[model samples]
Target: MFRVAVICLALSFSLLHAETDVEENDIDIEDESELRSKFEKFKVQYKKKYDQAEEEKRFQIFVENLKASKRMQEQDIGTAIYGITKFSDMSDEEFGAFYLNPVISNNNDPRPEEMLSADVAEQLTNVSLPSFVDWRKLGAVTRVKDQGLRCGSCWAFGSVANIESMWYIKTKKLRALSEQEILDCDFRSTGCHGGHPDNAFRAVIQLGGIMSEREYPYRGRNGHCAFKQSKAIAKIQTYRNIRPDEEEMKIWVAHSGPIVISMNATGLQGYRRGIIRPGAYACDNFRLNHVMLVVGYGTSRGYPYWIIKNSWGADWGEKGYFRIYRGEGACGINKLPITVVI
Candidate 1:
């Protein structure tokens, strides 16, 4: 009797274990089904089409990216929201190749020897900086632009953005400048692969001036130089590199106009909206990768942030703009504060 009872007990234990396994498998299937639904919606929302094999591959990547986004959301110290974006389907390497310029992060190009004029320097020195400044609100900023895929021409876009703001502030006329002109003509740096804003500034000076977007439109690819000297509307004689201090940067932006800056864009991969205060470890101060325009600065929910204009289009990150924590030099923002002198 004892032997029969022991046999029955072992069989019951085995059946219970099998039942547990089946339940876990059901949960996994449900999870995968949900993910598939989300992926289908994502493709539809972004207008993405893929072959059968490529679709499977991209769905896997999207799953991994979603996991990473969740990790980012959990780890973020600020109010940043991380979720599906236009880049959700891409792997990190593919995303970096298409959007970011890693070369700019380690750029060691020689600075121009030109200095700010004495009068301009005196004016900047004496002008009292306001607690907040928004070039967009002041009508100095143009509409946010989109730099299409596989073209890492952020340097040109950033440089042109600052120039447009400076030109508007000086002339009271805002005109969209051509980034393709810089990509085509600026031989100092590689065109679409990557370039520096300083090189772009020098290119503008050498090319005499930059033409309006109407005359030389953006093609999102490299092309032969088609710049017409006669069509040039705005010009810059020189550019100034500000000291890597947030206070000085604010003063400069308040008195002059928007400034071009480069910073680590790793955190931006998962960024959707809200002021990004990712803390120091999440966004390294030394690993700069993407260049952008600093159009304004202000405080939000007791956190001071820098308003940055991005080249990723109007749909991404606060209408093609983002804000980062100001005082801590978050993501190496203060490392490369540069602006053209109009």
Candidate 2:
């Protein structure tokens, strides 16, 4: 559910800029100087010290980000607060190609629906829901933060991470699962291009589970499957879809383990830090393209939010974690939630 929201979020934002060009040469000298001054100050505050060799390249990207920042601020569009960050050095195209991957295949066209069995999604209205849950802090998920790099295999990473978390919960072992295994072997998915995490999970089960990362390092690109039966470290007998209800999702995560979800992540690209609540940006307007895990749920500033774990590397956005507004189907977050039945 949340996955669709994220997928849509990224896709809409990407589509909005696909045919446009960034013209940077016409900046007035005064404005350019001010932007440079702000960028320099931001760099100092963040300790993003660029020595002489990287200055020219860094400055170019900084200028682009500065222009974007001013434009966004001037329009006063949406509620997300934008600023220069570690990613202030990468252009939108480079960032989209590298760190951002929205599911762009046919599955993206009609808006995805629950595919597996006709088993109507169960309503967990009677389920015991917790007010707060933090799986990362509780030690159920032992893996460290991960980076998807240039691959569009967030589906693979999200699925593998959940399986790995289940391994820890059931067997008391934390083995980093091989996402590369899925990237290479999962024919049902599109590897680095885009894929459904649900399909990736099905691939894992059919392949008799996955191996540790030590057995197969992530190539961030599609390659031959080198899955070794002897190296299998984690397994999922079956995976099921979670009810597309926010309350039910909280109950599941708090009681069971982390689950993969989707939501509008377009705003996340510019996120520096803080809880995200979209204003003026509605869910119906975006497309779902990205996939990630819902690690936990909590509140800040008296507002409820979901603590989502992204695969865009720890260097991005709050150490690769984000909090989106909870309830009212935040950015269509409670849309197509799925979990593994290990």
lDDT per prediction? 0.76, 0.66
lDDT of 2 by residue, 1-342 (tens): 233312211110111121122223344535767667766755654456667888878888777776675554444323344555556676777666566544433433433355332333253535566778888887777454454345667777778878887778888887888888998988976787777777788888888979888889876778998988778888888877776677777777887789887554554555655566665543332445567888899877677888888776555556667777778676657767778988
TM-score to true structure, per model: 0.85, 0.77
lDDT of 1 at 14: 10
lDDT of 1 by residue, 164-254 (tens): 9999998999999999999899997777777778788999999999999989998877899999999999999899887667877887888
In model 1, which residue pairs have backbone atoms overlapping below 3 Å? none
Off by over 4 Å in 1: 1-30, 104-127
Worst 10 residues of 2 by lDDT: 9-18
TM-score of 1: 0.85
